[model samples]
Target: MANARKKKRADIPARDRILEAATRLFTQRPFDEISAEDIAREAGVAHGLTFHYFGSKAKLYEEISQAAADRLDRIHLQATLAGSAPEKLRSFLVAHMEEVHRRRVDYVFHSRGGGTAAIQDIWERSRSHGIRLVLGFYGVTAPSLELAVATRAWLGYFDELVLAWVQGQITNKAAIVEMAFRLFPVAVANAELLGEKNLPSV
Candidate 1:
């Protein structure tokens, strides 16, 4: 039984080795430039095993993107569950920026053109989950149409803000956090006006 378990554990490293090689290759060059053969050579695995494990390069890219998105989702969920709207928002921004900094390579890959359709879908879903959590924390519940519009606008704003920060247009993380903090009250007020049906008492 112990030998069997050891054998299973040994296989996990090969999978991770492929992923690591792919990640490094993707970061160093354009997605089109990196071939499965390159990845197999870098990972020290048979080329066939790359296809066997990940099906295709596109699929492997999707898996990497999904993993990163999942990490971000977990961070946001943890922050939300820890405190009130204001606190949650602060923690969420901090955690998000920190994650981006830590996983900058993955961020770069997603920001680039390497993402597969499945990866794009997972990212969109994760974003929606974050926005919904924020709305819920603020006790906001508008009509479905209005909520959709507002959420879209808010997400666009959030995306722009993060992109600017990532591109070095914004240097101070604390300043960005402060700006986010200031925006929360206005958002909450707007929610109060638009979402009368589900306003929680202060």
Candidate 2:
């Protein structure tokens, strides 16, 4: 078993191993508490390799943050276009909740990323993608300012709901998803009231 484990580790690429180790450490502790040497030791690679592969610890952390954001974007992009807008929204939410739950540690870490600009940018970009998806469900590509603001506000609410769930403040995923879905029409209605016009049926 030991020999097989060693062989399996050897077969894995060094850069990937380092990244895996770094992710585990970063998620477990503040980024400032982890060092390149610590990542190398955890990855069972030479210390210099950490810098060689990633340039610096901060760069490595940024890469991890970007990767997490990209995964969420891809998942949102996979929402089917064939369903009714409400059905599509529910599918997006289900995909989102499952992905977040599967990587709750990473999700929580990047979601609250210690006030770093790079991480904040990543989070904002992911949120923007989500807003686009929600708007697309209503077939609105050129939303008015009021509509855009309303949609973003709704996204913010959903963000807090997921954050609460991941932090264990909320135990019912279905309830959170349904709540968000139920509020969608209200968001659109408010936008319409605010002078946005002709939003496609949801």
Candidate of highest lDDT: 2
Off by over 4 Å in 1: 1-13, 23-33, 108-114, 140-143, 188-202
Write model 1 residue lDDT over 74-193, tens digit each, in one string.
Answer: 988887786877788788878878877666555655655446767768878887777777776767554354454455566566666776787688888898788766765555445545
Give the per-residue lDDT digits (tens) of candidate 2, residues 27-63. 6776777888899999999999999999888788889
The top-ranked prediction according to TM-score is 2
Candidate 2 TM-score over all chains jointly: 0.87
State TM-scores per candidate.
0.75, 0.87
Error of 2 at 8 (Å): 3.4
Each model's lDDT comes to 0.72, 0.83
Which pairs of residues collide in model 1? none
Off by over 4 Å in 2: 27-33, 113-115
lDDT of 1 at 50: 91
